[model samples]
Target: MGETRREMKQSESLQASLPEDIALKIASFLPVGDLCALGSCSRFWREFCGSDVLWESLTRQRWPSLNFSTESSSVDHGDSSSLEGWRDLYVKWHAKMPEAMLVVQHVNQCAVSGSLDIRDFLKAIKHLNSMGLGFKDVEMFLLRPEVNVLLNLVGLHYCVHCLKVPAEHVMEALRNSKISQREVCVKWWNLGRLLFNGFGMRDESHCRLVSLQDLALPQDNQVLAVIHRGQFTRSFASRYPYSILLVLPGLSRSSQVCD
Candidate 1:
């Protein structure tokens, strides 16, 4: 029985004595939450899991566009302590994401209600810019059908028109009110009348048509056209000098044009 007990101890010791490289390899595969939890097991693990290499990998994976460097000329040449700068940076940026998401959600809600204050919208844009995310990074959420419609109403057709504008220039334009909503609408009206007699709608499979009344446009504002879903026919195109055209497939031929 004593010999068996001794053999069991030897097996346990062999398992615990894995090479450092192999141990690190195994730990590297753990998710961030699991790794942080594992770190609480002991001092050895806390230092191992919090090492610069692992955290740098995590930070880079989370925010690929973020350019971060941990190298510092000011650090003592021979003082090699486990660097935790990357871990701290990752934690800081992770905490900031929730706040940024909330700001974006608030802006989306305001846009849907047609009560989007230009100043507030610009402020949100500026805030997101400060976080190092460009329009392309967040375009997936920003270019949703509902959000795109609101953007058009505000004269910022991000997907179609504002793709080439630099981020700084966009912020400056927003700050200076360079894009007037009324002027943009008028331009669309003129384009429809002169070129094709119809405003180009986004190539989406489905869209919910919003009326001027539903949008709560000011009473003084004049709507040049109201478009409905249907096939785009030559007669319908020529019927109105200016029209908002929706080209939806599999929909009925019924359409309406509001002068």
Candidate 2:
């Protein structure tokens, strides 16, 4: 028994002493479950398995559908440490639902067309909120251009159509508004040419559609400024018009239009 234990210890020591690059390369090809199980080995092996190089390989293997360039967000939060970037991506991948994916795709379509209808925005928000992301997490994620465009559309929708307040103050004002008032303003309104238009169906199809230009109140520049102030970064504002057309509504309505 003593001789057997000694040989086992020597084997482990030899395995541990292998050059780290070689060990990581061997680990990179492991199946996901087996790779995670390898963490139960030596401390060195565990750390090696956790490296971004390996996880990035794993992420690529698992979710070929994701936009690797865009899906990667910094998981490291200061000295607190975090999983490798690809591992963080992996976690989010499994957590997403089909409904959420559908809503997000719709939001992407809305962003491109600059034709965000309030009902669709609200549905996206509901799906996003169900994901249990904190307001701060959402804010941080918005730094990504794709994410920023989607949420900016929602934020703009809330600012212009949901609340009479300006974009910059939308979130703050939303917090203070009474629950009853919010319910009223946030409901899907069925605007008709007149009372004779008949009691319209109150379904998703009946939701009002508005563009960023139509909702840019007081002045187009001012609305854009307010949107910039809300949560968007300066770089995003510069790119917004070309991608989202927030400043050009293709409407002849008054610039002072308010909800």
Candidate 3:
């Protein structure tokens, strides 16, 4: 009888020591909101979900379909007070992202085009910084001819777009350039009817070059839609399977991108 009890104890102990796969399987069925609950079960679970691959994969699984849109202005979009609502929602979503896969799910596998505003873009940068996330690639399509465009495009730092992503943000997150470790295909968004001349921007106003290294436009509209909507898919294929043309924004249209 004592031997039977000892064997049962050993069986339970072995289950406790099972490999990470079983634990991950259990975690997979959980909602993004409840991931932390699963992670709290054991140290292994915490490390498992915290990974970029795991979290990124989780993100693709949850928000399988997405749309990326912006309000044109206070009146067209909503009242000024709604800015607070936007900020609050962004903060809430950003906070929940770290807890699970919500943020990455929302951001990755996107081909952001059209005008993006600076203020909201900055908010996005703050969220990325908070969550330690990076983009696959970004292109800063210059749509306007205003001087604020320069200020707005200044934030075009980390990825492919030569616009308003903050260089300071990039320098601060120097180690954040995980993309460099891997080789990515050249990418360009819809540039038709848009004359962006920041490519030669070597003046004191511009610290970085606006040129593209392997800039190839997307040919397929499906992929462009993916980029257009800021939605990622489970399939991140190689060979630049997509070359597309779509309307996206410049760094100055910061409000559009960030909101």
- Better lDDT candidate (1, 2): 2
TM-score of each candidate?
0.43, 0.34, 0.22
lDDT of 2 at 16: 80
Q: How well is each residue in 1-259 modelled by candidate 3, as lDDT tens digits?
A: 9999898777657756978787677766765568767666555566665543445455433322222134212212345555433223333434544432332232222333322322333344444445433332221111112212221122233232322233344332222432211111213333234338645433121011122111212232232233334332211232322322122333332233222
The parts of candidate 1 lying over 4 Å away from their true place are 1-16, 70-83, 112-129, 133-190, 193-259
Off by over 4 Å in 3: 1-16, 63-259
Clash number for model 1?
0
Give the least accurate 10-residue stretch of model 1, judged by summed lDDT: 182-191
Residue 109 miss distance in model 1 (angstroms): 5.4
Candidate 1 per-residue lDDT, tens place, 1-259, comes to 9999898777656746877788688779988889999788656577778876787788776565556654422223255563336676667667666554655566666644333444444455555556654333343344223333434332233311223344344344433432222121111221233337566655322222343222223332233222211122121234332223332233342333212
- Rank by TM-score (best first): 1, 2, 3
What lDDT does the true structure give each of the candidates?
Answer: 0.46, 0.48, 0.34
Model 1 clashing residue pairs (backbone): none
Question: How high a TM-score does candidate 1 get?
Answer: 0.43
**TM-score between model 3 and native:** 0.22
Please give the distance, in angstroms, between residue 47's alpha carbon in candidate 2 and its true position after superposition. 1.7
lDDT of 2 at 193: 37
Residue 7 in model 2: lDDT: 91
